[model samples]
Target chain A: MVVKTVEGSFAVAEAIRECEPDVVACYPITPSTHIAEDLNRMYADGEVKKYIAVEAEFSAISALIGASAAGGRAVSTTSSQGLLLMHEALFAASGMRLPMVLVVANRAVSAPLNIWGDQQDSISQRDSGWIQLYCETNQETVDSIPIAFKVSEETRLPAMVCMDGFYLTHSVEQIDVPEKKLVEKFLPKFNPEIKLDSENPLSLGVYAMPSDYQSFREDLELDLQKAKQSITRVQSEWNNLTGRNYGMIEQYMMKDAENVFVAMGSVCGNAKEAIDQLRANGEKAGLLRVRAFRPFPFGEVAGALNGKKNVAVFEKAVSLGGAPPLFGEVLCALNDLSRKPTVSSFIGGLGGKDVTVNNVAKIIVKIKDGEKRFEWV
Target chain B: MFEVRFHGRGGQGAVTAAELLAVAVAVEGKSSQSFPVFGVERRGAPVASFCRINDKQIRIHQQVYAPDFVVVLDEGLLDAVDVANGLKENGVIIVNSKCDASALNGKLKIKEGMKVFVIDATGIALKNLGKPIVNTAMLGAFAKASGLVGLESVKKAVNERFEGKMAEKNVKAVEECYNELKQ
Candidate 1:
């Protein structure tokens, strides 16, 4: 590993290059544009091959689906409206059980035509059958790329590595860029069970009658739920190689705490600082960051918040006239607990609004004061 | 930890200035982080970027609300922005202006123990780079005024960021500002 001072986008691009996918198709968009640009430069320099500059985000993923079905490891990067445009293709890619990787520099969906960072883009695709992983730091984002591919290929499911746009993508910091040898040791070549070669042409994503379709859906559900173990096992193998501990949910200062704040993405860093300040003042505060958003990590989340009386789920994506996406999931995770935590929901940092450490402290204070209603901080 | 905010127009290289500063600090074996204020970036519009330098790793991912130094790339921003708004007491302000310290100090509410450094960066850029890009020149003044980083590290960072002739010219601009600001 080489330590380099670079933008989060550069670090991610370097990792993707190290992974050495067979085909890369991308359409550039803000925050994610740098990754595509760097990879394109590498392609021009004869470093990586077969980079197809597609016409739109829809074509980008469609191209990946084609490449993966052709028995090749494929990758792409996009955000916001670009990801939204791929909504139809997203389901097709997963339903066909084609293993590929998508790096989503997560951004808010546009209605007012805003182009800033938020989780709305990927969060809205919760039912799309892609494994979603949210990262809090650039180092974690870089580390998770190879892990995503390993898990995706293992589970026969496509994975989305979601990093907060601009917050992590545009930010410049020091990160350890893993070498090619290390990546190769962790992730071997792609050897799919089936492909579309003329030597053995096979049908894929074929039409299913309503009678047979429900069984296919049930199979997908079972595989997704079982992917939690694949994620954990792959993370462990990566941890052994890199000496970094990662889990579905990371707990901070939660051993003895009554109030816990659960969040994901870049906001978790600020929440950790808030927890430190609150602890300095003699308050028992803690934080739990959800790293894997899909396959939901239900068991780990419940174990972390089992005895806590108050839980605040701070998320950037709202379901619109319903509980926020993460908030609803947190409720489901705690459903079997004998004494459930009074879980309050907060929706903020939409469109890259500054969710400062001060805001985090105020949210915890409100939870302490018995404010259980959903709030917009 | 030392936090610095850079205020400049969209085309003024404010964001690049912050990133280069972080790279320079990293060269000295220190941890630094930098980022621009996310929004619709347009030319000639008021913009700001932030940088933080510390001995340990930085965990906070929020904007810098209280900055130890503020650098203004355009003097016109003084009228449009309260550039020194959350600046810490005894802070520093560096600007790429033809006006002297007292002239610029008259516009800002300079606090006790606070210092301001003024350099004709636009003139220096024209003399060296043959253009009005003053970000690298302002970085030189920032180095001397704050005494937080060495001139050699700043020049090295500039050399790494630009190539051949452009790198040589930027290094010259930095040296001119550093020498001119010497007390």
Candidate 2:
């Protein structure tokens, strides 16, 4: 592990380069632009085998689908409207079971046309059949890329490693970039078991009538849930190699705590500090950081918040007229609890609003004071 | 942990300055984080960046609201933005201007006991780098005024950030600024 002080985006690019992808198809978007830029430079310098500068994000993902179908370890990075532009293709990539990786610098979608950090972009694609892993720090983001690729290949599903835009992606810090040999040992070359071959011609993503469509959907769902095991095993393997352990949900100060703040992405960092401050004031506050959002980690989340007095679910995206995305999921996870925690929903930090430690501590205090079921922090 | 906020025009290297400081902090075997205020930035718009240095891992990911030090890259920003807002008492403000302490005191609304250090970073940059980019020069003043980083570490960070003549010139600017600051 070589520790270097660099921008998070460049660190991610370096990690992706070490993965030695056969093809990288990308269209530049703010916050995520530096990754594409660095990879394109690597491509020009002959470090990467192929780099396709697509006109738009739709074509970028479409090109990745083709690349992955042709048996190449493919990857792409995008954010905000760019991810939205590839909405249809996202399902297509996953529906076809094309194992690939996408790094999303999570940003707010716009009718107001803002370019800032938020989880609304990736959260809106929750049903796209891709594994979603949110990161709280640059080192975790760097580590998640290789883990995403390994899990994607193992589960035959695509993975989106979501790092907060302008928060993690744009931040500069010191991180350990893993050695190429270690990654090589951890991840074997992408030799797909099946691919588009003219000699042994086969079809993929063919029309699935109602008779078979439901079963195919069920298979993908089951495989996504089972992929959690693969994620854990791979992450544990990575831990053994690097001494950095990660889990689907990181429980911070949860033991003997009555109240917990649940969140994803960089907001978890602020929440952790808030937990520390609350503990100082003799308040028993904990933080549950949801690293893997796709597999949903229902068992672990339910286990952690099983007997807590209050669970404040803070998220960057809302489900509009419905329950917020994460809040709704947490509610379901804790549904079978004999004594369910009073899980409150909070929607804040949208459009890159600074969700400071103070805001997080106050929410915990409000939860203690029996605040409403939902709030806009 | 010590937090520093930087105020500059969008075209200036405020963000890069913060990053350089973070890298220098790393050279001292400490952890640091730096980031710019995200926005649809233009060349001349007022912009801000932040840096935090600590002995352990810096886990907080929010902007530095109450900074221990404020570094202003352009004196023009003093009239345009609240460069000193949320600064803690006894904090230090380093400005890249020719103005002395009393002149800058009239312009800034700082709390009592908060020292204000003035350096002609532009002049230093012109003499050493032959450019108006005062980011590296300001960092040198920051190193001296804040006593958070060493001059050699800042020079090494500059060398890491730039190559060849650019690195040499920036290091010279850093040294000149460090020598110019009385603190």
Candidate 3:
């Protein structure tokens, strides 16, 4: 266990490299370019063997689909606009049941052409049938790699490790970069459910009749549902190996709390600080950080917030006409509960704007003052 | 958690300085993070970077509003920007200048209990590295002023980044500024 201060992107790249993948196909994007560059450097230094630098993100993910179908452990990385361009390929990868991992240096999608940290990019892909996990630090980014591969391979679902773009990718932080030998023990080689070989002549995701398409879609949804268990199981295995366990949600100061702030990604760190300050001042404030979004941990979220007097969800993206996507999900999670807290939503930190500790604490104060609100901070 | 922020022109190595400090802190067995902020950055434009050093994992991913220490790589930024805008109650500002600490403190008129440390880091860098890249030299002064990262670890981090004569010059620059600092 060699601990060192490294940038989040490089840490992620090293983690993926330690997995000893068969292929890494990716293109460079700001805040995310270092990930590909580092992986490419590993190849140049003879630390890796297979790498494919594609024309664009669309091709990057598409190449991964081909690589994964051919029985290779494949990986890729992208940010806001690149993720948007690869939208179609994203669904195809999952629908084809090609298990792979894609690291998302989460950034705000552009009209003004901004490149900074935000959750909108991955949040927009929540319905694409991919497993999503948000990371709070570079340490978590490194820790999630093996778990992502394990869960994806088990459920045949493409898993995404979403992290705040510049916030995590560009920031230098201390990470326990795992050894390749240990990671290999944690992650066995590719166990493809079906492999495509030239001599064997196989077909994948092709010639779907109406009935076949319906069942394929149903199985895809069912597999996504089943992936939740695999995610938990994989994390349990990782905890047994590394003694580090990050469950579906991380709750801070939630006991005996009257108000709670829920958030994801690196912003959860800010929410935790705010909750600590509120607790220090004798306020009953807490924080619930959702680590997983797809197969959106509804039960755990509802269980955590059932008896709270108020809950505030601070997200970085908007769902246009409706409430923020996370806020909407939180409401759904709480709807079936007998006890429900009035939840408010705030969209903040867009385009890399600062989401200060003071901002989160202020929202907690508002939630407790009998004010239910949803607005940009 | 102790927070620090750096202010300098785009061409200066303020961001690199912060990252190197984080690496040094990590070598000390503590958790640290560093990031830079810029918008349409140009040469000589004001750029800010932030670092947080903690005994445990730090969770807040926000800009340092009330930094325990603020490093000004260029003294010129003192007039152009509100360098002490959200400083902590007992924060210190380390400046790279040849002026006396008392004179710089009086000129800034910062908050009460806020200490100011001035060092001729630019002069040391010019003498050793033959140019005005004061980031390494100023880092040594930062070690003197903040006492968060050790001078030895700072030198090691610098050595890892540079090699041979370049590394030796930067290390000498750090030692000169660090030794000259009359804390």
Candidate 4:
């Protein structure tokens, strides 16, 4: 179907339909509410089956986990507090090696309570063991859902596809809705190696002493280590089908860049425009988009920034005592690299303060002006 | 290159106006960027949106300090924001109000070489869409004042944004706003 106007929520629904998930469990939250409503509508219309509107985000994930554990392809979505509410369950889903996909509408986590666009909500859960992909456009948001499912199920791990709230969520745009046949071809039916069944009767989540528990945790670490390669393989398959190639990191004009801004999610779109404008003016500035966050592609990032003289890492969330969370991760990634760029951290857009191209340009200028320190505005 | 700043309250479709303008410009094969800035995410809080359209890709992401066009969606915002602070010498100010352009201009103390255009967008929106939302209506006047985009493009964008009968109503509002500015 040709979709002329689509909100980020509906775009997600369209992708879910294409993926043909066996079960969809979601709770209603600001910005994400429409996604649930759209899926429910599709379910009611008989376009999609086995859609479950759950009571809470935790239950939503739990239900999907149960369904996925039973050898059914499952999906869920949440935002901000809802995502935080599902934190414990998120870990369980990953630990159990369940192949599920979650759609996260990135929203500001609150003490004062903000329901707007920001990355803190998802970034806060960086260590949840799920592969995280940040999207910059409505089209990317839609396309990522099935791709996420493909990657998640391929590795038998959960995945989170994140888009900014209200910015991509409520905002409408023209997006190409792929045909169901094409999606089916790209994402085949999900078949799991282990599942819940009466006949098989295998015990999961068994109590283990420290002796075995350490090895269990280590096994999970090994799987996470394997996910980096799995992501590359799955992305190749996706690219072969859709003709769009997205990696753990998407680099833009970074090959010859002197100054580069590292960003994730929708801000990279703005940052790309800033880089293009600066490049036109003889400023060798570019952007590196962090598409995959969890199995943090450290080597790829290090390689991308190897030749750059100055790098500015922009994070939407502050790390309280340490550098911005993303900055810390990037620095860790660059630890063993032969060439490391001078890294600076800048935090902005907390509670959705709008990081425009001008803000990024300012950072680039600061980097060029010999500012090696970190700042938050 | 032209930069426009829009001032309105949240939930008033201020960001939509900027986005629609950006899309329309992109449809014409030009480069444009639209983004919003605000603190209070809820409705009825002051919000500002910016748009830049140029022959080349736009890089500056800061809020427009010097705008070639100023679109004021609510008259109340005049008291709260410096709407005309950095308006270009030949810039035009479009206001969604019943007050005459000269009267509103005097109230704003618009600098010399600046032109002001005023329309009762709330009235038009109420008449056409049965809502007080004036973003689309103001966009129509924006097209007339700046001539950056065609009115047809605005209508198409509005039709694309809203669905069913609502899209028809918004398209009518776009036409009315366009004709109002023409007059």
lDDT of 2 by residue, B1-183 (tens): 999999999989998999999999999999999988887778999999999999989888987888999999999988878877989988999999997878987789978889899999999999988899999999999999988999999999999989999999999999999999987
All models, DockQ values? 0.85, 0.88, 0.74, 0.23
TM-score versus the correct structure, for each prediction: 0.97, 0.98, 0.95, 0.86
Question: lDDT per residue, candidate 3, A6-111, as tens digits?
Answer: 8888889999988988889888987788899999999989888798989999999999999999999999999999999999999899999999999999998888
Off by over 4 Å in 1: none
TM-score (chain A only) for the predictions, listed in order: 0.99, 0.99, 0.98, 0.97
Clashes of each: 0, 0, 1, 5
For B1-183, candidate 3 gives per-residue lDDT tens digits of 898999999989988999999988888988899988834467899999889999998776777778899899999888888888799889899889989877776558598898888998889999999999999999899898788889999999999989999999999999898898888
- TM-score, cand. 2: 0.98
The top-ranked prediction according to TM-score is 2
> Model 2 residue B138 lDDT?
93
Off by over 4 Å in 4: A1-5, A369-372, B1-68, B72-89, B120-140, B157-173
Least well predicted 10-residue stretch by lDDT in candidate 2 chain B: B98-107
Single out the weakest 10-residue window by summed lDDT for candidate 3 chain A.
A184-193
Docking class of 2: high
TM-score of chain A of 3: 0.98
Q: Is candidate 2 or 3 superior in DockQ?
A: 2
Question: What CA RMSD would candidate 2 show?
Answer: 1.1
Where does model 2 exceed 4 Å of error? Answer: none
Model 1 chain B poorest 10 in a row by lDDT: B104-113
- For candidate 1, the iRMS in Å is 0.8
DockQ of 2: 0.88
